[model samples]
Target chain A: MMEQPNRGRANIVGNGSVGGGAYTSVRIVGEGEVLGALGCDTFTCTGNCTVFGPVRAGLFKQRGDVTVKGEWSGGHLKTLGQLTIEGSVRAAKLDIVGQLTAREFVETDNLKLQGAIEVNGLVNADQADIRLYGPSRVNEIGGGRIHVRLSRLTAMKEWLKPRHSTELSAALIEGDDIHLEHTRADIVRGNRIHIGAGCVIGRVEYSQSLHVARSAKIGEEVQL
Target chain B: MEQELISKKDLLEQMDISYGQLYRWKRKRLIPEEWFIRKSTFTGQETFFPKPLIIARIGHILQFKDDLSLDELAGTLSPLQTDIRIGAEELRMRGLVSEQMILRHAGLALDSGQLPFDQAFYLYVAEHMSQLLRGEITEQETGALVRLLRGQLPKLEGKLCELVALRTESGSSMVLHTGGGRLYADERTTIAASIHLDEAIEAFKKKLYAY
Candidate 1:
């Protein structure tokens, strides 16, 4: 167990190791855990790591598996592993390449996800571009520009899954420009709306234009 | 002329309002629930709004944001009217509707002096009698206008209605309708002027009280 501030670069390796302190750069090489709040400039974790408290960093990159039990905020966050956030996450830019499970909201200026994301709360971003690789669920999404699509792998996986339906479920999705595919939402509202293939929507209200794909199912479409 | 609609994105960008601000206003009921129109585009589901109405509303909210809270603004924006009183002299002074027009429509003689009008009576004149002052319709048309509004007043209660005036080659007429009921002036009347009855009344009051 190490409990001290590392001014420069701090690297932890091997199993059964715990590092807790503020550092300029933190690199967790193996199965390392953080017991206290950790603040760093550049935080990279290659092996599985569990952060017990909040984390604030300039740049956070996770390559293996990481779990944060408290709120997390950083300038830029890039995750390519199984990341579980128990609390909200605030970041300027978030790039996710693997699976993300967040209990609360995810607020970011720009979000680009090429994998799966599940959230109990809303995802509020200035701009969000998500390509789902598997079944993903979110309560609500609001932003300026939101584009969600299902990747080929996701479609294949859904076909192979035992469940009959694999569409992403969301209560509401609202934004300026919104395009969704393989999504099931109660209501979708925006300036320009496009419901692509494999979407089941309850109601849609738009001001300018509305285009619905033949494969999509919509209950009602109203132009204001 | 058909009004142009504005895309939600364009409206926010043009007004410099964030998504958070728009949703906050919506949650506060400052913006009517029906105004959030949903449509589908090439991209996905999007929201749209009536361009002029939303612009005016946003402008009013921003202009008075410092003077009033969001709740207060919503109150002012709402069509509900509890107590609205206007003196006949004030109405005449403001030139909302001419004395002769009121005398002819309401049958109030000038010699009887000025009297305060309730919200319904004031709204009736603001909606129908204003056209009389503008010389858009004849004195004979006032009878029909009065009967229509008088009949609808009780049904309206404190709710709002839209007064629509239509002008055709034959003549001009007025109509008032809430969501439930509709009253038309004449069969040949074509709609030329349309406005919210409460808004017309409020505008008249503002003009009268400005000085």
Candidate 2:
């Protein structure tokens, strides 16, 4: 398909609102609200932004807080603070340093998470690299390679402050190669599965190989 | 009517396929999302699939994975993605649809250029149902069925549904409804033939990809 000429740019300097439409780039510096569906090449939010409709962008960068009432589809998304998406998220690459709450599914080609995530639906990614800094929860995780571990910073900060929970809780986790630390799951299935330290898994199903840390607890193991 | 469902655990055991393969196929759209039925079981919530449908789909995937890439397999398995366009001549040459059947039912000439997937799908469904019914339905009724499907299938917007040919003393008519529901006819009317739209589409895809 031929690319259409961009509809221009929309920028919010302070507390402002803009009706959503196709744009070349959207830059929100302060509190901003998009009233309808947004389609843009680049969306950069510095403070806070609330989108009442779906978002389609090529590059989405958020520094503060953003809530999308509808689905969000983008190519490269990097968030430094918090993100709340009521609908599903479909992206090529997602990099988050803070918290993310998605009511629906979150699907990406590559996912890099450093903070926490709460997803009511499945989190499907081709390559998921998660370092939980806080308690995280997901219904199911399925993909090619899934690796979840407690963040190094979170581990080091635990000695300074009282211990804080930094783990991932999932009902089902399935992939080709999976290595999880500080994760609690009902079922873990993969070709090569490694249950790292502080993991409490109900069952482990591996086809090729399996390894469980001495500190990890597993209810059952089956070689498929 | 309720479909028989196989739990995910049981399906894995029965199919001898790993969870990774199943999830990967699902991600690739080889398996439709609607087929994944989640319900609360004794062991919390679990996923289930329509037994016969999932079995057949897994068999098809296993048969083709050796020869076709997952993306190509997805193109054939996914009915929602209908980017395939072919000329009537090619359709005849591939024998996916007989030229006589196309000419008689679709009323399209051999020289009619490239046919979009929707038109081709309508033609395929029409020919399939007519052939199945054979002498049970009249030629006029068959033509009416084809016309009804061609008009209404597009309106359904790719919903998983069924086509039912109904016959009564007065006349014969066709109805399309979402599948998995029992369509009852009064004593006077008889349900002549019923076909699942998804199954038909899968068969059509197989035929199209066979070449």
Candidate 3:
């Protein structure tokens, strides 16, 4: 299934819509849309693109805005601009430099984000390195090695506009090694948890060790 | 009918496992999403799991972590993804079901190219029931059980159901219904033997796909 050979290539040089099917490569140079499910080897989009159905590609790279009405699943996904998915996402590797809004869950093996993310459902990843530049919100986040902090550039921008807060808010966060900064959460549970500066946590539960910054506000702390 | 539940706090403490491992297994889909039951408590919100099922699953994972990868463990542990088809010769060779029993059961011909999942399941359950109720049930009851399962299993796919054998002075009959609740029998009949369908399926898959 991983080897897709001898399939036709779909190319949209201008604004157009292509019916989704198995393809060796799908390249959209300008605005385009996919009508149905697509299974391709590689999908690349330079301008905006919309996929009405699900997509399963080997390597997916998008530079401009992209919206997936259905689920998006692939081996490697790297996006530069804004990305929105109405359904869930399952990718082995996800790298996003801009904003991401997912109405459902997002599961990946490795997630590297430089901007903000809004997920209505849980975000589960094995290794998550999120540098929030804007406000982010998620229902829950769980994984193995989770690191979240406000980017240095965002901190400089927030210093001038102190009223606006660019923090990551989650209802529940559970993992093994967790380091959080400027994160608001209802509950945080992990083995080794470090609550960095500018965090408001309702509760903190740790098994091994816990370090809370003086600037962070915590309602309760329990070591189990 | 309510199932016995263990909270997230107690489960981690009792299992001596970290939250990372639990959530990691969940992400890998080794644990079904429906098992995580959330409810409001005085503290705000709490997550719970069906006590016995979670314990058994975690124990299984711990025992096999050294040998099998998570993907392989998921293939054997996940109940909702049971789509295994075995040939008649392999089934007979594996001795999953007795030869005489397969011969007696309908739609279980030895020469059938491939035995569908449902047929193989029915035969497995019938054989299990006969062994469980050796003295209580007769060959005719086994046939009846197979028929009852064949008609009801499709409708209750991916759900936890039960196969019950009821006997009275008149005769014996079988019934299939969703599990986790008590079944009431009138004054005439008594419940002979009841088998949880999901548990049976899990056990069957473990036997078939185990390395």
Candidate 4:
């Protein structure tokens, strides 16, 4: 049998110029297919797949999905599309566009996203989280509503314990109103913060108001 | 290698810019983290800073962050100087400058520290401060807050509590540790807190969040 060359098939490579709104098909490694080059306008991962080198996409805008049944490390992953996984999500730094629902911890310094972040462990968003889950440790350039599920948390510079007294990080939280669910530190000093019930902060230093809860617990002297 | 000594007030002053500017820029949507220094000595005091470029960076943020909000000014600002926002009243009684300025700023905004326990405003102050600045006098600012509270409940149990600070303005400052809102004291108000003692003396330190 002679080789029949199929025409009209476009092979998109790294240097190839694909038109806008293009849909590229990618084959998963099911029956032992080590897909070396991962380039696409739309990408998806199923079962166990491994990238020998690095994987780059158009920030999920090109539509890339990684179930990551195996291990995905090194480099960066930017998804303008939605990413949903129930596996161990680990990375040096990750930036996503869609929602991030991980069953593990997230440690990144630069993440500018427009989707919600729902993780089980600590979430450290260096920039902003349009939506969030659980307690976080971050150095924010802006302030957003923080939901800390843990009893207590701190940062190298600042934290979102917007209660009576929390620790400091070195960034500023500018919300006319902030809420510290509970307090349990040594000394808390800064600007204006509105605290709530069941808190146990330690050193209650400088701040704005001192709205105490009925069932709240306090330490020693409160200097206002 | 040895680093220079950077004062706490100057460092806080530098952060004041971004914290202030971001508030206006984002319109209460975002705020940056505070600047923190490592507590080298015991008593949770004695911080270390690279004095050469510290104040200059903080001054940069303070200079520019007057109206920039959190989302608008992320990498563009920082707290390098040490100008704390304490009044003259706080400077006199709790006059421990070199030891605990970070602890003083933990309430309102953010402070650059490692621990979060210091962030908790010991419940009493944090809760009250949270409710006080609501533009009205609720049940929160009426009874429990006006007087010094002492109880035998679990709230007062466990650790040995002490409220010793490292940052003071001069002798007086209007510093208030409201529940956990913003931390700002007028002239009569002095920023102070009570703590349950722990083995780690560094836990006693304060971190500056806002100005």
Candidate 5:
């Protein structure tokens, strides 16, 4: 079903779709799509949904596949399934499970990612905890505290997808305190940094302390 | 009067700044286009800058580049209009300037209570107080400084210009020129303290433009 611009609240059940418009609260059950900009107070999608334009919401929760083609900003965003954002995302708190892909920067106060993730631009947060499941790639990651570790399901997924590697590849990773495992980067800078096993890095610049696992490969380490 | 010009090569060598940094700053409008004077020499076409102005500008940029982002530094170097307000007590506590002197020189009545100062008034106080702290200045000089600042601050609003300082060969005096006006200070004066103006204005702009 297709509807015009909605102002107050909207609920799309089953395979219903809405056109570009503003809504106070939007709830999409089953498969639904929004063709244009979406401004809402709360957005909840239980199934598959696609937003083609910028989305501004106070609260956004998705339990299934979701895709946003433009910039997105919200107070809180929680996703349980595959979430893909083509543009930047700014949120107060971001908690994701399953799989996530953001083509541009992701700025948040706190971020917790379980499963696989890919970001083409920087990921800046106050605190970030990432558990990598499959091939994950981020151009840059900066925050106050960051921890990245591979999940136990990596081997199972590796067997399922032999073409994709289970390692994380990043150009730069910077933070005040950083710990990484099964990751590869060109440069890593922080006040305290620890590179765990199965990691390869070009350079490590740390201020206070640095620890490199015996299995990690690093080209140079500098204390500043 | 013939302006003294420094070759691009000489300026880069003297300032110890890279060519990339200079071009980047130029692209950002931190340095004026007219400052880049092109002339044919034995080698080929060469660019030049007014020696005194370029030196001062480069020094200022280098000093503050670490504290402020390039965009913020560009804002500082440019004479962008700003509306900065501060309470009298807050100013005093911050030690940005001497409140007593502000009252005496800028003619701000202390008994008028703790009213906030506008941008021009605030900058005037900051400029003079920085000078006053460097050393002793005659009452006449203080009044003249205040008058000069008052006259210049308003005109600088909404314009794009840079503050440039030229130190004398003897290193005993310096001339600060900005927005077509000049102020001379002796060795006892501290020019670095004036960096507060850049910081203050940047903070104000951040607050004003925060969505």
Candidate 6:
């Protein structure tokens, strides 16, 4: 038997196409170029999804894994299966029971991704446990427990480059209590790390737990 | 050139100000889009005043809310004063001593950076937050505005976020189990990450004690 969603609450705003029921519905858009949308007051889909327009669901639920091949901009994107999104996915909380794979972008307020996340482009999250194979911009992690194996952690302030630091091949943050660990980059800032290990840090600020494995080499002083 | 200053009361009258909104603004010192238009009586032609000046003053007023006087607001308003300082103690109190702390909290912090909500809400949230976190709540694992209402601070009962509200763990020193997932930690320098709870016991902390 199909599940029935709470009625009396239905909203379909903007331009898009929608389908499914309140408990077991599916509202999706295909092409990213399309300007319309598929909306439902309460959406429930057990099969597929391809939404390009804005989605507003009072209560949107799905059973099977949903593939967001295009960009998704809406209130919430909650799915039970692995969500493979190519374009940007913006929502309050993009909760996916399965793995979330974004080839291009994924931005959200609070993301609870059960499976591993692979980002080829930019992945910005307030609190996320992501596996980034490409570049990423993370604001603040709510649960400050991350597992990233990257080469370098470029300070955002420096990355913004005043359009003047052209000579600066890379940006290195210098200060006290800084740490750099397990990275491939060439610079180090405040308290460094012990994550991936064996990285060439440009400089050391204040690393209380700065560990240099036998495979790592330092060509500079340990202090300012 | 002649500059026009108007009375706040008159400006409110002109703007058709409601009692609740005005009271909320005055108490919180949060000026929204209309901004704090310096109103002085000069004959009777109404003016919107200089847009840029008012906007600039809006920035100063926000910073100066600590002091009731407009003069103090302008004098103490410094962009440099806008930095968030999570002391080492506070950082660990929230159980953020892990690698994922920054990644997870960055979103919450950025979302706050995006709260184009009226200044009043911001002040009410900030002030109450300072109070609740600094002194009220016992644990730092999670926080909620409702908890503030129960304490000395008034309640800010609003759905700040749909599934989540602004959260911080900068006060509790207990070992937290994020309920799911294991985070990488480096004992030396881990910063606490704030979570956006869903009307949960978050978003409040007592204003830090006056130094």
The top-ranked prediction according to TM-score is 3
lDDT by residue for model 2 (B30-85), tens: 88787788898754577888785678789888988999999889867555444435
State TM-scores per candidate.
0.53, 0.68, 0.72, 0.33, 0.53, 0.32
- Cα lDDT of model 2 by residue, A18-77, tens digit: 987888899999999999999989999999999999999999999999999999987999
DockQ, 0 to 1 scale, candidate 5 = 0.03
Question: For candidate 4, lDDT tens digit of each residue in A1-224?
Answer: 11234312223333222221222434332312224433333343333333332333332222444443323333355655555544434343466655555555443434454444555543443333332222222322223322222222223113444332332221222222334544333433335544445455544433456565675554643433
- Residue B192 error, candidate 1, Å: 71
What is the clash tally of candidate 1? 26
lDDT of 6 by residue, A11-115 (tens): 233334443223223433321122335445456555554544444454556556555545655557677765666565666566765556665555554565543
Q: Against the true structure, candidate 5 has what lDDT?
A: 0.71
DockQ of each: 0.08, 0.28, 0.43, 0.04, 0.03, 0.02
- Cα error, candidate 4, residue B62 (Å): 5.7
- In candidate 5, residue B87 scores what lDDT? 48
- Candidate 3 pairs with clashing backbones: none
Please state the i-RMS of candidate 3. 1.4
CAPRI tier of model 4: incorrect
DockQ for model 2 equals 0.28
Show the lowest summed lDDT stretch of 10 residues, model 6 chain B. B202-211
The window of 10 residues in a row where model 1 chain A has the poorest summed lDDT is A1-10
Candidate 4 Cα outliers beyond 4 Å, as residue runs = A1-177, A182-189, A220-224, B7-10, B18-37, B40-48, B60-211
Candidate 3, residues A32-78, lDDT tens digits: the string is 99998889989999999999888898999999999998898889999
Model 5 — TM-score against the truth? 0.53
The local distance difference test score of model 4 is 0.36
- Tens digit of lDDT per residue, candidate 5, span A1-224? 12446477788999988877778789999999998989888999999999989988899999999999998887899999999998988888999998889989887778899888899987877788998877899987866788998776774665576444678899878677899988999878777899997889988877779999998999889886
Better of 4 and 6 by lDDT: 6
Worst 10 residues of 4 chain A by lDDT: A148-157
Q: What is the TM-score of candidate 2?
A: 0.68
- Candidate whose lDDT is highest: 3
